[model samples]
Target: MGRSFFRRDPATVARELLGCAMLHCCDGEWLGGWIVETEAYLAEGDPACHAARGRGRSNASMFEPAGTLYVYPIHAKHCVNLVTENAGVGSAVLIRAIEPVWGIDAMMQNRNVSDLRRVTSGPGMICSAMGIDRASDAMDVTRADDWLLTGGHQVADRVTQTPRIGVSRAADLRLRFFVDGNRFVSGLAREHTRPRRDVLGPDKDPSR
Candidate 1:
């Protein structure tokens, strides 16, 4: 995908990224997988977003150009997001989960786990699996030779949208998207179920 692919609404990018692949080349070894789940964080009225309070030393990457890597530390681990829209806009798409496809051994080694299912199953695990950290923050994945996002698989019909999990504020807004029935998805069965359009439409204002 090009820079234009990420220069859009965070929710739209989150939904469309369900089947995309995020690959990172580290020390001549490739590590990555097909994206299985994601959550969109908007610049407007989303208090759960890191940039909701405006850019700071920790969240400065969130204010970078679209396609930039926004890595933030949380609970002693790190979560990665792709900055969306134009520069100075704080919106981003958080990659919640991925199905390991390439460099499984390296991913397992990075995560220090033997179970394949445990690898790259959540946001923090993804960062550990791919060796992503604060050092990668603000790097433009679109232009980087080491970091690449590719069209991995087609899963339009298999997509499911629901309210974002693990967020206290704006948790009812349907901003989370994932591939239905993909084992790599981190959310539980109830969490991944698509909500009724009339109840909370996919594009409903998250502030509500």
Candidate 2:
């Protein structure tokens, strides 16, 4: 069985998540991407976090037990975010970017873009390719029905951490991480502030 996404700490889970597979069933077809990057948003008095104000209808999942999928719309586009940590802790890991692996043809059809690099690197693009929408906000990540986080071969050798993007309050947070040198990773030229780590740890094989 695949490692349960709910059984890990939010910080550890965020770092270990790179290269995992995000699968979604759309129109009787399976579409997914390799998780090349992510961002950690802890509830720790973060003004930019929705949970900063405490739980509500839209952000209830953030307060629920870990492993919930918290999808929401940003700038009129849907983005997929995962809830982490224990209930009422209000921590989450935003799936910032992905590298299209399976169903590239289907993703192209959905995005209508010939440039493969632009199809799934950003939050909005990933959602567009995976068919995520506002209706998918409360999805359960551990389920195989509509969405699931599956284990996969970890191909990312170097993971770089940097500040999150487009956030007014948490602009200085060194929480965003990406697979170094991957074409699908965003902001390749930007200087990172945090230390890079081997994505899968020492015990894991480099080639899975």
Candidate 3:
């Protein structure tokens, strides 16, 4: 076993976590995935981060020491991400995407779909498959009980950085990072844009 995934610096941690593995223990089975994408949320005054508005009960994990799990819900449809960083310091790195590695059967079962593309790829889907929720937030990632971030083979290729997704205020912040050619990455990247046919439907008028 290696050291915990909790890092004191969010930016440094985000970059380092790229090729690490996230493990989940469920019902005597072990489920794991490779971290393919991530985003760093800096402390207060960082317009792109949740803690930028100051600490509160909901985001208390942001202040805790690194290696703490910061899980939370977003848009009422997804359990967005987990933050890893120092406690009570408002620094965290969000796990944005993953590539399933261990216990594929159980991951598929948890996701309730068979399509590999839809399982354990996006942040919310990864959370759903790993049994993470608001209740799991702030949990210790170094613990053996439920979730853990473990050391794995380091990523050798250069990572690509992009603007954070789905936010209006910090949309310009290039905090999101991902492996250059990973297909398991979420559709939020620039290359993952919807097909032009979908954007301009067959019957839709071009001037709208």
Candidate 4:
């Protein structure tokens, strides 16, 4: 992904990330996953955004340049974020779910799950499965030097948006986006943000 890909508003960027591949190099082995669900957090106005209060220890990455990773933990579990918009703008796209595509065996082993969907279906699941941590907090996602990667794929009318889950403030905002019908997408099926035109089936690996 280029810096321009994340230069837009967090909501638009979140929706656009559907079907994009997250390339990871872990333990000297290449691993990949396709993004299926995302949630937008805006610093300027969103109460749920970590930057709502201002730049601090937890949200420092959110104030960094575009294409940076803003990873943090929630409920003692991890969730990976893509820092977007301008520096100090404090906007990020929360990668809420993904469909495991490459290094399936390693992902399965890391997650301790034989089922593919369960391996990286949720934010915490994908973070743990991907080995993302503070060490990668500010990694440039556009890098190809065996670090992070964001690759595009076809995602037409399969996207559905809804309110972000597990947050009390700004809970009703329809900012969550997902590839409809993707089995790896977390959350209730009935709570889809909007009506679906067609459900994009299983995820396919996007080649570099």
Candidate 5:
């Protein structure tokens, strides 16, 4: 996938990113996995977004061009996001979870865990497993040789949407997207059950 693939609404990119391979080359070795879960943060009216308070030193990357990496720290761990829309847009898609597929041994070693389910299962884990941190912020994956995002496998009916986790504001907004029945997804059981649209009624559209 190229920059154009991400030059759209953050919600669309988040939903369509499922099953895509995210690879990061480090020290001649590649580490990554299939994206299984993501959350979209809008540039406006999204109180949970980092750019909600206005762009600054820490969130400048979120305002960069599409395909930019906006890595941030939370609770001593890091999370990686892909900037979306045209330049100046603060919207981005957070890669919440991934299914380990490449460099499993390296990922496990980095995470200091032996269980496959624990590796790259969440946003913080994915950053640790892939050696991503503040240094990766603002890097354009669309043009970088070390970072690559390949075309994804369409999940279609298997895709589910739910309220984003770990956010107090806008908690009712169902902006999180994940592959149903995927063991790699990180969240409570209810989050993986069914799409929120089934219960939120047709009047509500969180994708906006």
Candidate 6:
């Protein structure tokens, strides 16, 4: 991932991150998967954004430089966010789901599951499997060689967009983007969006 890529608008970065692989080095091993799903939280009038009110302790990292990690907890489950836009501007892209493309056995052990889908298909689940937590907050993802997005992924598949899930406010902004038809791309089971539409077409051979 380049600096310019993450420095763009939150919605653009969220959609463009559909196929990039999130690489994380753990215990001397590189573990991660394709970022199949994402959601954008803006700093302006977006009610779902943490900075909608203004910068504070809980959302200070959202105002950090682009590519900073903003990990937070909700209902005992943690979710990771990539800080986007400029410093103090307050915006980030949520890494909603990842298809576990590496370290299957380790992920299974971490998540204590046998099924692939159960291992790392959701935001919190992926955080658990990848050893991501509040400790990762404020870390610069762009500078971390071990925890950065890698290129060369060819996702020749439909990219779908819909309103964000879980937030009661501004839940119909169509800010969530995901790889259409990917089984491991999480959240579809709990949250359903009507009249979903495709935003991007396949560029090359998709992950499938």
Who wins the lDDT comparison? 5
Winner of 2 and 5 under TM-score? 5
**lDDT (Cα, tens digit) per residue for candidate 4, span 1-208:** 7889998899989998998788788898767677889999987768999989988987798998899999887787788899889988999999988777788899889888888778888889988788777788887877647665555568758788788989899999999998877777889867654542333443544444
Query: What would you estimate as the lDDT of candidate 1?
Result: 0.85
lDDT of candidate 3 over 28-82, digit per residue (tens): 7767677778888877556867788778888787676566677777765454445
Best by TM-score: 5
lDDT computed for candidate 5: 0.86
By TM-score rank, best first, the candidates go 5, 1, 4, 6, 2, 3
For residue 28, model 4's alpha carbon misses the true position, in angstroms, by: 1.3
Model 1's number of clashes is: 0
Off by over 4 Å in 2: 1-4, 155-157, 192-208
What's the lDDT for residue 157 in model 1? Answer: 85
lDDT tens readout by residue for model 6, 1-208: 7667889899999988987878677886666778888999988879889878787787789999899999999889899999888898999999988877777688888899998778877889988898888888898877876686866455544677888878899988999988876777766543423332322222332222
- RMSD (CA, Å), candidate 4 to true, equals 2.8
Question: Model 2: how large is the Cα RMSD against the reference?
Answer: 4.9
Error of 6 at 199 (Å): 19
lDDT, model 1, position 99: 82
Ranking by lDDT: 5, 1, 4, 6, 2, 3
lDDT of 1 by residue, 1-208 (tens): 8999999999999999987778898878878878889999999989999898988998998999999999988998999999999999899999998888778899999999999878998999999999998989989998888887877577898888888989999988999998877777886756545531111012211112
RMSD of each: 8.0, 4.9, 10.2, 2.8, 7.6, 4.6
Candidate 2 C-alpha lDDT tens digits along 1-208? 1325654555567777887877787887767777888888877857777788888888887776677778877788887788887767888888877877667789989999999788888989999988888778766666547665766656545667788888899788788877776667666454533333223322222112
Cα deviation of 21, candidate 3, in Å: 0.8
Clashing pairs in 1: none
Sliding window of 10 residues with minimal summed lDDT for model 6:
199-208
Q: How good is model 2 by TM-score?
A: 0.85
